[model samples]
Target chain A: MAEDVWILGIRMTKFGKHPDRDLVELAAEASMGALADGGVTMKQMQILAWGSIMSGGMGQQLQKQIGQTGIPVYNVANACATGATALRTVIMAIKAGEADFGLAVGVEKVAGAGLLAGGSRGVDGTTWTPRGPVGAVAPLDGRIGTETMPGVFAQIGLEYGHRYGGTSFELFAKISEKNHAHSTLNPLAAYRKRFTLDQIMNDVMIAYPNTRPMCSANADGAAAAVLVSDTRLRTLSLEQQHRAVKVSASVLTSDPWEEACQVLPDVNTLTRNAATQAYEAAGIGPADLDLVELHDCFATAELVHYDNLKLCESGGAVDFFNSGATWRDGRIPVNVSGGLQSKGHPISATGIANVWEICHHLRGEAGDRQIEGARVGLAHVIGLGSACGVHILEKAAA
Target chain B: MAAARIPLVDYLRLADEPYLVASECEECAARYFNHRVACANCGATAFKEAQVPADGVVRAFTIVSFAAPGIEVPFVSAVVDCHGTSVRANLVNVAPDPEHVRTGMAVRLTTFPIGTDSTGTEAIGFGFEPAAD
Candidate 1:
């Protein structure tokens, strides 16, 4: 494929519930910041790919709010990985010579929605039962509805505990402790308050083994990225060049049927497949990555990703964490931006937020969270079931 | 009995089968799921349906506590593979105790209900449980 697609700017809103801002308003603020950072007007954008998980409108309303004129605007909704999917679409369009400049924006405003509603129906065309043991829905029945993301992830922790000889308390606590510590440093994080392992272990259980803190908070936020082809980048003034980060590769994949039980179909094997493709496309391995942003909606998801992304071998993620391989000052410095665990998961906004964080790292502008001398970075995101998108970026050479 | 009209065919199919249902190119032997209008492998819409085996080893799994609506708390979700076909589904019928579940253990398909939509119907679905001896 073609190399050297430059990111002229990146921006994100503070991730949390914003009652005053609707989805469109949240997306607009980030879009404005990105446009200003890129020193480009909205009129110059050749294409707009808007990604949102549950924005009521399919992003046409969002585009209008952002003052997007008569450009080809495509709306994408890919659950949690929506942002990365949007970015991949932009990159693919640019590679196909479809556009010189592209914009990818992800936004979510999740509040007031009942958690136990709106699950994906089953193959026999039956709706998944919501949370809580009520009526005939026995606690032992496997047919619980979509409200089970946290419950599903908790099982991951339990399995990890079984394999590593760690207690459920130890495994889940380590993940919470690490991310909570990381979040304390992030001003924009949802749960800035840190928790002790004792607290995590003893906290009220939302699921059997998963305590409240072990889960991600649903919130409202938006993130945006501006991509320009190499041909367009060459025309930028010298001052504008200083802010650019190059896109090394972008990859997306869906899950196979068998992976559903191993991990979420969209995220499990798809993440690994996408990461492999991204690594190959970027001509680098996981070892070359200076930093990373992962979809840690639950503490267990982050631990599993340690193996799925090949940051460690299979069944070795716990040891990797215990060795401090994923810490900010540790080997790879994963989630230096404070992953979904700390930063809050706004669903669609999360994937773009990862990208935004990576761009900030590459531009050397990530402030206290910056990885020193970082040249290469990776961003990964996954939606419900096997849909996933991964992107690799490098600091633009001067 | 009146014939039941499936609420959402694609959604139900996904929930029931839990397999990435795609076509493989006869020319390239490349496999794809999600009913690709055309083969991503060799650009041919004409292809054969391939059901990836649902018996893969556990690559990774997670337990989600703070689930969205319509899902229960403390349910086990995992990624399993049978051959090259990978799927993500709920781990079912095992004891609620965490000690009983293993990553590399064998699993198979079982039916369950996801939820009814605004129509207020009982929609049944499918999930994975530990394979029986």
Candidate 2:
């Protein structure tokens, strides 16, 4: 039988531009902060799994700044799912009995990176150039159709509206408004000011039905967590054990082959697959979840995910939002930490930061936005190369 | 000088009549754009060249107002469903706005110059335009 894993400590750097801080510095802050929070030292860590999108050999470089621990280290990069992937690496080690104490840190420096490109940069940046031993070729982006993040997600939202009635530009804007409103309570969020419905609706349009405000804020940040096996937790201090959050389920999935998926990533099917497996592993359903922090890379994405995560009935995401169930005070409050939109999506850091939010609510340390009695919560993140990760966490039993 | 023209992609045929071709799966007959080694739907290695109809209905679309460094903004990007196969392309010969473009709008394939090389060779790209029934 596999041993259980518990998050002993978790820490996240404020999500915003840190022009003075380098990637290693941000990573070190998160790593040391997590160690202190867990009441453990770096020397006690048996393994390290570091995730970053913009850098490599981060685990080794991170060790130099923190400590020269000779433990096995894994460097992970999976687009936006990098952080969750790194955390999962540590959990697997603990479950496999490889290590009792493990540390996972995710960091990225993408502030001012501008729009995320879907394909490679072509020579002219306008037409498709076939790859081969031939002349200078351009990218497939502008020629065929834009594979840009904003365009892809905007199409996804419009498709949902076409498939199911009741979704409109105003509805999508309303979703962004809610997230902006939620940001006011999250001190770590990049943009704390709330926007009215008109502000979100009238914001600079990046893509139709998705304005600039609806898009995820690209920022620099890092988040880290320390995990300990259940047995190790028992030997820890009484306070540490009391504050631990149980990792009931950890799952990661990729896009299954579908005709449509080959063209435009089917963010829906993979997310559903992960969610189903996570719920089955956790022995809980969406109904039982008290809070959720999902990847709202775009406002349009959040609506579709509400259905993909099974938080609502099939073709019922708009209705679910209309019911006010996703608000902080509602039945199943979501993105109480302002989500990726306001909390700022630092790519690799976002995955673990989402888990950090759930852990906060479960530990009752979420301050003003706390979801009272958040015994069970779920955190989700999906990247465009088509990776989806779902983790279910629970408050330690009294 | 009349600029020499060339299709932007190999899948587009510029001979005689301009139209798009796809690789059809032998097992499931699912059509896909460009070259494919196997079927995404059935996983069959065998494929046959199939010509896709020029006409399709806009299943989904977006008017992009922001883009990367060099690409122009406020263009109509759309997913057009020809029969059952979906094609990703842009809507052309029409204004990039909600009033001019919409889902379920009838359109057909058309080609336009993406750029011209120093040799005066024009690179042509495909897009969908409002179809005349």
Candidate 3:
């Protein structure tokens, strides 16, 4: 027999530009809120898992400031999947019977620096390069090169457009239109301005195929969740009878070497593998999902994700988009919280934010962004270097 | 006139004649390119280097308009399949146009200068070009 684990509390800061706060301040606020929401004191927490990409050594600093009652803190960084990785670590600790209650928190603060502002090493023992339009800066090591994030995704759009026989503007416009409409109802979204199809089509191209509106804005924020074992919830005098969301499964996988003719399982295979394992663990399929929060770092990535997640067959994502299957009223509403496209991506915080949104929807506290009667939700996060994490959650039976 | 410093060993290989290096897993039959000391598939360290073919088709490509210092913009980059390995390299000697490139189009390798290092020495790298009929 297996013991059940439940998410008792969740909290997140509004995702946007926060020049006033650092990663620690941002994370502590969310953590404090999560503790209050769960009605659990800091002394009850047995473990703390902190996720942040850019803030080095900030997790320990935050834990100390919050006074976790001498609880063990584990810091993790997996690019965009940092948040999900932290939550998955907590789930594992609970399942292993090592911890009765755990706190998973993720925070990111994007200052004036751009995405490629950080200096890093590459595979060739050289500095990593940042790719962008004219006047891009060379990496510190001068050996590695740089490319804009949008530029990389633009390649996908170029391939998609060439294969489908449509202009890049047409393909990207559809994706922009979908996310913009979805964001109109999400007050926390960074860009709430709705976009017309014509406006999207005519927007200046950041990359050849990707326009400014089609790309996600860099943001700063934090999200946190409190997880407790079934027995622990009862012990803490927390309302155990209340509805709870159980973590069905969490899976992480890296990219595999692909042949030249084959589409490298980079994003597609990792997502499919994680999704398959999660579904198998939960005993459900894609058709059973009520809602999903995916890494739509770019519109092209979203288009590819539709087919990659097995929501549609290969090359059939456009058809699904055309039919409005991904809309809020569609069979499976995607990115209902405006997704990365509208919500803004704060890197490390993005993964935890996805979980925060799902938890809110499950608790029926998502006000305007709530999907009607959403009982189950899935969150997918992908990081650079082809790392991915997928998690599935289900609301307790009424 | 400054004399070109020649390497004692061949450090640069042509894109059309790109060097073939492979890693054969002792634990599994999985093979990889650019020499992986450890088998990623089977997690085996016992591996041997094998030769790979230089010919392959384009898997995907993009024309970059922006580039860092010492690098040219409006350049074509591609993921090419050579033998069984898919390697990413810059495509040169052809029009840097996205429309001209297509998936499954034949391509070959060539070597060119990337830039100077901190030591101020010319560094060369492999790039690709459209295959001649």
Can you write out model 1's per-residue Cα lDDT over A1-398, one digit (the tens) per residue? 46468888889999987999878888888888888989997888888889886754456776677665788888987878788888888888888898988888898887434342225432332343333212122232234323366656655555555556544557656777888888877877766877889988888666655677777777789988888888888889876776788888888888753423322333456677888888898899999999988888778778878878889877788788888888888998888766776788888888888888888878888888778888999988877655788888898776
- Candidate 1: lDDT of B28? 66
Give DockQ for candidates 1 onward, in order: 0.19, 0.48, 0.23
Residue-level lDDT tens digits of model 2 in A95-145: 999999999999998888888675456464433345542222455666567
lDDT of each: 0.71, 0.88, 0.71
Q: Model 1: what is its DockQ? A: 0.19
User: Which candidate number has the best DockQ?
Assistant: 2
Instruction: Give residue A124's error in model 2 in angstroms.
Output: 4.9
Off by over 4 Å in 3: A117-148, A154-169, A201-204, A234-243, A256-265, B1-11, B14-35, B43-52, B67-70, B112-124
Off by over 4 Å in 2: A124-139, B1-4, B36-42
Model 3 residue A8 CA deviation (Å) reads 1.1
**Model 2 chain B worst lDDT run, 10 consecutive residues:** B32-41
Better of 2 and 3 by TM-score: 2
Q: Which numbered prediction scores highest in TM-score against the true structure?
A: 2
Tell me the tens digit of each residue's lDDT in model 3 across A91-173: 88998899989999998877334535223422232332323321112332222212456656666655554455433557667
